[model samples]
Target: MNVKGIHHLSAMTGGITVNYQFYTEVLGMRLIKKTVNQDDTSVYHLFYGDERGNAGTELTFFDFPGIRQNQKGVSSISGTSLHVRNDAALAYWIERFTEHDVTHSPVIPYAGRNVIFFEDPEGQELALVSDETNSGVPGGTPWEHSPVPAQYGIIGLGPVKLTVRKPESTLAALRLMGFTEKSRIPALVAGQEDIIIMQVAEGGSGGEVQVEPRDDLAIARLGKGGVHHVAFRIEDEEELLAWIEVLNREGLQNSGFVDRYYFRSLYFREPNGILFELATDGPGFDTDEPFETLGESLALPRFLEHQRESIEDHLRPLVTKRD
Candidate 1:
């Protein structure tokens, strides 16, 4: 099975209104899709990305009301990063974060690239990594109308940091999925040993994963600000189906196949208990809505269209419009 690269990262949030404002206005991302979680239609599943919510550019959130803050530790997707054009974009973000009162760290190098770590109001661990040196997996185009200039706007998902307790098992799983060890880098988080960096096909910032073995920390508890799962991009349904058989042949259990409407998916937990998903990149966010006003109103998959009234009634009005 040939995995393309990072598909999208989904996370949890406690407050939808604040989250929407921060991502769209503060970070200058486009709300490419406004939909509800399919499993539980009461809460919203907001998708923020570039102009079209391309697979690699998506950073989505599920607003589960009253969820507690994320408990940081091991066996988790510790951090998610976004790709900016170059080092100069880092400076623009620092200034923008400061202006908007977004808590952030100074510029620093991690995994051979300059990045600035920052947190949303909900304490979501995130970073903006410069793609000045990238040569592999190309980045998506930024929304032309974003408040942040196109050069400074986030273009795509960058290398994701996965902190797990059992590095060998996770490493083996990754290798089975076509990733190879790239190199080792110092752990970005203090008190941890060197991190093992791995990359899949045409690896670069977009196609890499940083694996940190942290036996010293406790297992992370799921809550607001915690990442739900990180997905790897698959070229098409055929590739996805072939992978299912590969995983089954190896005796590794997995979600046979799930149609997520926008994209098909196969989910499973690695040895360390971190959820991993393999999702197709096609049938994108534009499948249901018009290209002009993608996220202007609530959008339901055809399957859920019948229950839209009840779904809308349970959801509180989330104001995303700017004056």
Candidate 2:
């Protein structure tokens, strides 16, 4: 029972309109799904990535207007890595960011590859890596509003580096979740400079889990632009159940199965307070919309049928068209 690659990464955002513009217009990803946060109706939950909001191509957000900013520290998520096609494309992104006047750090090396680090309007750390081998995604998608082009954009996932307070307990829990310790290596990342620890499975991509030794478990306070949760892919319902059993046997607390529109999810916070979700891959984004017209409209799960009108009423009006 091993885990697969990343399905998507979700974050909290404050500005809805700017967040929409930056992800779609500037970043070049398809706005696959548009809806309000199920828990918080006032905020919008925006999804951006390759066409169809496919796995590894998604970077999701929950927009909270007028919220305070968060501080960058040991317990916080280091950053989210987006894989680009080549060094030339990486350079293109650098120029694009410059053209937009988005303040970014100079190019730095990370994970044995050169990378450029920057933050979004909300201070969520994001980076781009130039490693063709890491992500075999072609950089060209013909979708009208495809991000980075289907081919050159994030085809698959890289690794999500973390700074945990307790490595042993964290490692033990991950191992129970089917993660195996692979190796320790040198990192090319600029911000989290000290340790480069890694572990992974065959179907999934692994990132460095760097532990910054501390006194106790860190309580993460979410503000404007911070990662809300990191989700891992499960092949199907069977895999999801297996993990549920594993977690229960190990005495880990988890948010029992919740049926999301596109996928079924189970939530659990790791020892370090970073929320982790295990999501099923079947009955995917295409379940509601056809492959041809994905992201054409707002789709919701059948269970939320009664709330459809209310949900639609609360969402901000937006449209996606070919430029």
Q: Write the per-residue lDDT of candidate 1 for residues 224-302, one digit (tens) a residue.
A: 9999999999999998899899889888889898889999999988899889999999899889888888888899999
Candidate 2, superposed: residue stretches over 4 Å from native: 133-144, 147-151, 185-194, 203-219, 320-323
Note the residue pairs that clash in candidate 1. Answer: none
Minimum summed lDDT over a 10-residue window in model 1 is located at 314-323
Q: lDDT of each prediction vs. the true structure?
A: 0.91, 0.66
Residue 109 of model 1: what lDDT?
A: 82
Candidate 2: tens digits of C-alpha lDDT, residues 1-323? 76665667888777777887887777777777766677766556777766666665678888776777865544556568776766776777778889888768766766566778887877877887776444322332324545455445554445676666665666676676666655555433444334534444452233333334344434456777777778877778777878888888777799878778778888987777777889886676677767766655666666766788887787667664334
Top candidate on TM-score is 1
Q: Highest lDDT: which candidate?
A: 1
Off by over 4 Å in 1: 188-191, 321-323
What's the C-alpha lDDT at position 9 in model 2?
A: 85
